[model samples]
Target: MGLIVQKYGGTSVGTVERIMRVADRIIEYKNAGNDMVVVVSAMGKSTDVLIEMARQIAPNPSAREMDMLLTTGEQVSIALLAMALQQKGYDAVSLTGWQAGIATESVHGKARIQEVDTARIRSELQRGRIVIVAGFQGISEKGEITTLGRGGSDTTAVALAGSLRADKCEIFTDVSGVYTADPRVVPMAQKLDSISYDEMLELAILGAGVLHPRSVEAAKKYKVKLVVRSSFSQEEGTCVEEAADMETGRVVSGVAHDEDIAKITVVGMPARVGTLSRLFNTLAGAQINVDIIIQSSYDAAVTNISFTVSSDDLVRTLDTLAAYQEALGFDKVEHESGLAKVSIVGAGMITNPGVAAEMFQQLAEQDISIKMVSTSDIKVSCVIPAEQTSLAVRTLHTAFGLDVAEQAVVHGI
Candidate 1:
């Protein structure tokens, strides 16, 4: 009805032909009488290729330079899409993240958006032109280029939608919509018609890959409606919003699995009152996101603390723990990188029992061993062997009755 923000991922605009198709799609939306602001990621594998090129030049390039180099990918995307739209006799313009007024902190490669100055975007919108903004990047207060980390394009789109007060934010991904499990892994995985913001946030943070957690956070905070669909098809996709009414009987909404996880254990720490606090605070100071933490007191005088972090942070986490060994008073620090986290999320799980038991039983039937376990009101995540990730996902997907009968939709409502 009013302004809408649309985002296309790398695969959606991978080539000139794809870019033309995307332009046509945008034109159709414009013809529908709605103002449009589009966000786009780099062409397929272009960002990875750039990273490889940078590593070829320097083994460990500076994060600041990486941001400068990586932002070019999205710029390429915006420029090409704008050119395609113009070639089709449509009024279109391209703007980089900073040109569109995206301001961020000075965190070189992984900056969070601080605020958006919408004057430039609003000005372009008033001229009846489709504005294509580079996604995943912005500028810092010190006039430095900064990139939002992985899946940042989704964050950019959602943030822009909130700032513009857009009617909806459409995320055009490779998948038709959010699924009960990864369809590639579980053939029976069903696409959801709608999901709550909190459920979607949990799935994204747990590695759903359809949307980013930060984007869902912004959507929930600003009450932005989100529609996730495929760029390649016109299939009706999923709507993510606040569930109007909480229903009973459905305990497990979806199963999420992540392979990019590593666990660090600080073993035999002095059983002091503030040992856990000091250990975690030290990791926090390093900006490492710890997930799925586990602690046990093996004896009266000693305790074991284990936590998971991104695989990229595993080395740094181990190094930090080793450096602070004396301060943390831990006898040994061990790290495991060959682990995966498999989780099931459902809002109904808070009031429903036996969900975790069923999940654990299914995994056990599949001969999967759980290494570390973490539970929230709505989620139960377990760390297991990375190799068994797919098996675990499939098992749990079927166990939770998430599979379809004749079609890919779950049986019944």
Candidate 2:
């Protein structure tokens, strides 16, 4: 029998009926003679509700205490799903992160997994029990409760699969599979049958939201195969592996977009080499993330730098730059909010000539200006006005021939 690791998202376990549906999905795998270990997230909106409740009590709650409170959501999901499986006449047991031996870094809100002690899970499987794990939360070596940041459950599931040396990891969610673009934004977005690890990593980082970037990173590092499909359907789904089928001959695989981006520009700085390094170091000290940096030079020794950060980090980023302004030796800082980043990603584009040119030409035709640009061998991203994200995504989806004849369902729409 092959050993398998699977994870279901919040929407898949949101209600009793939905939980029952997921249990049925699990039973099919079990009956196929596979040893099963399932991971699950909190019920739909429950984590959000808990966060709002905590913020209601205090605008800024302690991260450690928040981890203690937020983990209860997944606890609820695991117990209920375990009960559901048992009621369906299957032997099942639920184990929280600590009980299952998932050890992570001491960081509370966004801890990274350090190791997995698989003795307990292996024992349970040998006893003919389906093991259920609480995803997204784990215990640190110092005995602190910690959570993987948003979509960390994907990380948890994949981590388990790698540690246990399972055959493959299956990530079931509300959406059927990874798409060329978010179906909600672009109705004609087509689902991809398969994608390479590098392409998925870019999508996840660029706000695909279908899979977590950390999980993709782990999959590549460990060489574990991943399948993303909807828990609610029997679609073929998308397979993520080291090398994907390249027979499609499509230069650009998909267009991904992220709204709620803000830009910070530091004006009039010496073109000295370490100036840029020290300036970014200031933000790094504050744990602020930077993306898409562009530098403009007026003359040989004077330059201006513009960089993008998620809007959620705008205040922190601006304050960080201002505090170091005098030390960093910049004339002034300028800021812009409500910007969006739309990117086209594909491994096939590596050998395709003029792929970025095609993207620019299409955007130019629609009069959508590109503010900041970032590129890799397989991806090109343009930051445009937030209000124009939908237009930009759809325009590029068709431009790259990623559209299907039918509309796609937008979960949570």
Q: What is the TM-score of each candidate against the true structure?
A: 0.96, 0.94
Q: After superposition, how far is residue 342 of candidate 2 from its true place, in Å?
A: 0.2
> Which runs of model 1 end up more than 4 angstroms from their true locations?
245-249, 406-413
How would you encode candidate 2's per-residue C-alpha lDDT over 1-413 as one tens digit per residue? 79999999999899999999999999999999999999999999899999999999998688899999999999999999999999999999999999999999988787899999999999999999999999999999899999998899999999999999999899999888999998877888888888889999999999899999999999999999899998888877899987645444768888999997999999988899798899888888777779999999999878999999999789878888788889988899999998999999988888988989999999999999999889999999999999988988999999898899998865532
Q: What clash pairs does model 1 have?
A: none
Error of 2 at 330 (Å): 3.1
Per-prediction count of colliding residue pairs?
0, 0
lDDT of 1 by residue, 252-299 (tens): 889999999998888998998898889999998877889988888988
Runs off by more than 4 Å, candidate 2? 299-302, 409-413
Stretch of 10 with least lDDT, candidate 1: 404-413
